[model samples]
Target: MFCFSCCMPQDNVNQEPSTKPYQDTKPLASIANLSLKTDSTRQRYVAEEIEKLGKNNISADIFTFHDLSVATNNFDADNLVGEGGFGRVYKGRINIQGKDEDVAVKQLDRNGFQGNREFLVEVMMLSLLHHQNLVNLVGYCSEGDQRILVYEYMINGSLEDHLLNTSPEKKGLTWDVRMKIAHGAARGLEYLHETASPPVIYRDFKSSNILLDANFNPKLSDFGLAKIGPVGERPHVSTRVMGTYGYCAPEYASTGQLTTKSDVYSFGVVFLEMITGRRVIDNARPSQEHNLIEWAQPLFKDKKKFHTMADPLLEGNYPEKSLYQALAIAAMCLQEDAASRPLISDVVTALEFLSPQPGDP
Candidate 1:
């Protein structure tokens, strides 16, 4: 069990004191100044920002810290389910709209890579976006220095847990389940690219960010790094390069110019992972096979060799034609030229064809 709170800094006596509260009339300016002050003040400013943005849009609850604490049994170690760069996720039951429901509570680590800025970004993004393939944000807690987010609990946890297993007793995802997950994830990305106003680029699209429910339906989670897509005539948004290594698009990593196609490229890597059941980066493997793409690239040219790329754990159970088509989509997505990458909608269409229908052998 991963405990984020246990990793918090114990000594805060030397921290700077909070400055005088700024007027709400200029909330943006006030937030800018507040962000430079004490951590507590910054968290308060984040809460204010969330309230302002959520005035007309957000339906998520503004949960009290005490209530969430009680819900997670004070974030007991036994409740811990997952951990990330942001912090630990705990499985808990909380009453929402007067009904008992299971939820995953993501408590922010004061010292983690994610800070108040990422916290605010996630709240703003998830509050406005809605899709079956995207994880639902139930509520959040931003009191004092504690920043926590509550989401609908995913029964199967992340795709990474099932795909890259270390336990010998664990069952690998069946071919049908893998295709289902791939299709679901593609639809989620398609929604972000085509449905949302102003569009959204899911900057972080990795196996770990893909969560699965009890039915093995995949939902994209962790929108802290998500950015608004370019508008009007702008072809791309220029920003600092940020995303997990091995999953980021080569062009975005090199130029810092981001577009919807960048996400397409990342999805390609994930698609490859699904087909091969290998980590993007693995030092444990032979040096020639350290990177999944570098090793798989040569195999893409020869259809006969595609079988070699199929997860050994599958034991040759998947359909050969389905495997070829899936690999074709993956190759198209992994194109070196960002312009060559197909739109997410195209990817979705291809995946829909690949997914098996009910009662298919």
Candidate 2:
């Protein structure tokens, strides 16, 4: 269910606003102007923008800084769940209507890679889009110098945790689970590409952004890089190239021409990661084998070498025929020509056939 709630800080009404010196190194004047000469003015501008979004029927909770502070136990390090270039995500519980729900609170670090623009894009995109395979945005907080987003907590965390950073005590995902995740993620991308009005290009698609629930159901999160697809008669949306290295489409990387097919190329890279259990770029490997796609190109051409691409962690547990079918789909998606890459819907169809049945081993 897509819903939002607003809460204001009740405890600090009478206290004087802090007079401490602002320490953020970046000049406030550069942040969308709106006369952000002071922290209070910037907060007001952000709040107004959010209010305008709400008026436009973009449903999202307006949370006060105090509400999130309490929800996250004052953003305690103990509650931290994940951290990246953008900022840290903390596990928090917030009251939704009458019920207390666990949520992931993503607070933007002023010094982080992303800032106001990315934050606004994510809120607007998530507010307007909803899908079973897409992460749910619960609410947001725009309060004095604080920019935070609230999302439904995914119990199992990101695919990266299970795939690349598994510890000695943690068992890797089962073959069935991996197939399920791949299929679910494909569906999410399909929704964005085929169903959404004007379409949406998921400019960033990688394992780290794919989150899994307790049931291992996959949902694509982090829409800050998303852009509406090109309109009729246009081949692609020409924009600045910005995406994780290794997963970006070759054509898009070179020409800055973004199409839904660019996302297909990225999906191919992630699917390859699932099959091989190797980083997209692993410097630890022999120099020649550093790039996974480069290393797999020859193997992909020969049917006999296909087995070598399967993750050893699978321990020969997956069905051989299923592996072949999956690799075939990945190869199609990874085609050098963006025009040659299969549509996300087609990828979903192929994955549907590869998904395990009820009684399958």
Question: For candidate 2, lDDT tens digit of each residue in 132-220?
Answer: 88898999987756789999999999999999887778898888889889988998898888777678899999999999998899999
Cα misplacement distance, residue 3 of candidate 2 (Å): 44
Report clash pairs, candidate 2: 5-61
Query: How does each model score on lDDT?
Result: 0.82, 0.81
TM-score for candidate 2, residues paired by index: 0.87
lDDT leader: 1
TM-score per model over all chains: 0.88, 0.87
lDDT per residue (tens digit) for residues 1-361 in model 1? 1121222234322211122221122222332353375754666667677778667546789888889888999999999998888888999998988899999999988764356767877777777677888899999988777789999999999999999963778889988899999988988888888877677899999999999999999999999888888889999989889999999999999999999999999999999999998999999999999999899889988877889999988999998978887888888889999998888877776676667655677
lDDT of 1: 0.82
